[model samples]
Target: MTAPVAHAPVPLQLKRGGGDAFIVEHSEEFVTLASTAPSPPGSTVEATHQGDAGPTTVRVKVRGCRRDPLPDGREGFRIDGRFVSLTRADRAALFGSQSEADPGSTSET
Candidate 1:
């Protein structure tokens, strides 16, 4: 398995009641979302990202929770969680596309 690669941060949205959304900074295996209140430890949250193919949802477990003060002078909680079940194809789409062959590898015909 390859190490987690760094990609540009994207906002992930979780559908909530009354047309509300939970925005999060999402990566391949991890996501961070802001909230006015902190969730209980070891809670499960689902984040969904809609791509050209379809909507990819990942089950995230809240492992680390803390209070964060935003630069805009907003106070809230930050939820840090890891993707519980991220598939290979979804990983490629979310993080980045992984090349099948190594570009640095040299081969003899």
Candidate 2:
């Protein structure tokens, strides 16, 4: 008789959303948008990059949901939110400064 094989678990990558775009993370659900945001407990909120197209107002809506286990066996929270009419300054603060040549490029440094 052949022995059963065990498969390795996959890792999760948290991505930052752009203007009007928000990220959502959950045990089994993950999504991204340009107008909505996520409000998970202990989750840090920030603005998007400058010159990006989005809303001015940002809204985060969090629900009482459990997050999936990380590769390191750490627990996380599930959240969601929204952003309205975000300006260049707002984007710069939230994300980062936009590139001089590429309007869409965001400088993390």
Candidate 3:
């Protein structure tokens, strides 16, 4: 299976009743993040990432959360989640205007 695309440790905002997080990696199916708060499994969280067109927002289902080290060597929470839903436009906004053949478009659920 292909691996998730690693992203720069850019801060991602969790809009509406959430905390900040940093993107660790992502694929069409899943996104991993580092945050200061724990998200219980089966919960949904909305996160926004800046793109070329504008800010792309997505809701993810929390699969797991564990203690981990952040990029800056501090203790943090590592969050694993799957995309709750995505549309054609959302895909474009998240990974640019690239085709599905691109590595960023791995799997979608």
Error of 2 at 68 (Å): 3.1
Q: Write the per-residue lDDT of candidate 2 for residues 1-109, one digit (tens) a residue.
A: 2222122321222235632333322111222222233345435345432224443333333323344433344454433433334446653443445464247656566
- Please give, for residues 1-109, the per-residue lDDT of candidate 3 as tens digits: 4579785675667886666778778876888888867788988878887776788787879999999887777777898988777777886666555454375554576
Q: What is the C-alpha lDDT of each candidate?
A: 0.60, 0.35, 0.77
Q: What ranges in model 2 sit over 4 Å off?
A: 1-59, 62-66, 69-73, 84-86, 98-109
RMSD, one per candidate, in order: 5.3, 14.7, 4.4
Q: What is the Å distance of residue 48 in model 3 from its true position?
A: 1.9
lDDT of 2 at 25: 25
For candidate 3, list the clashing residue pairs, or say none.
none
Best candidate, lDDT-wise?
3
Considering TM-score, where higher is better, how would the candidates rank from best to worst? 3, 1, 2
lDDT of 1 by residue, 1-109 (tens): 3443333444445543211124456654666666555656798766676777777775678878888753234686677877788888876555555443235545555
**Once all C-alphas are superposed, what RMSD does model 3 give against the true structure?**
4.4
Better of 1 and 3 by TM-score: 3
Q: Model 1, stretches more than 4 Å misplaced?
A: 1-6, 16-37, 69-76, 99-109
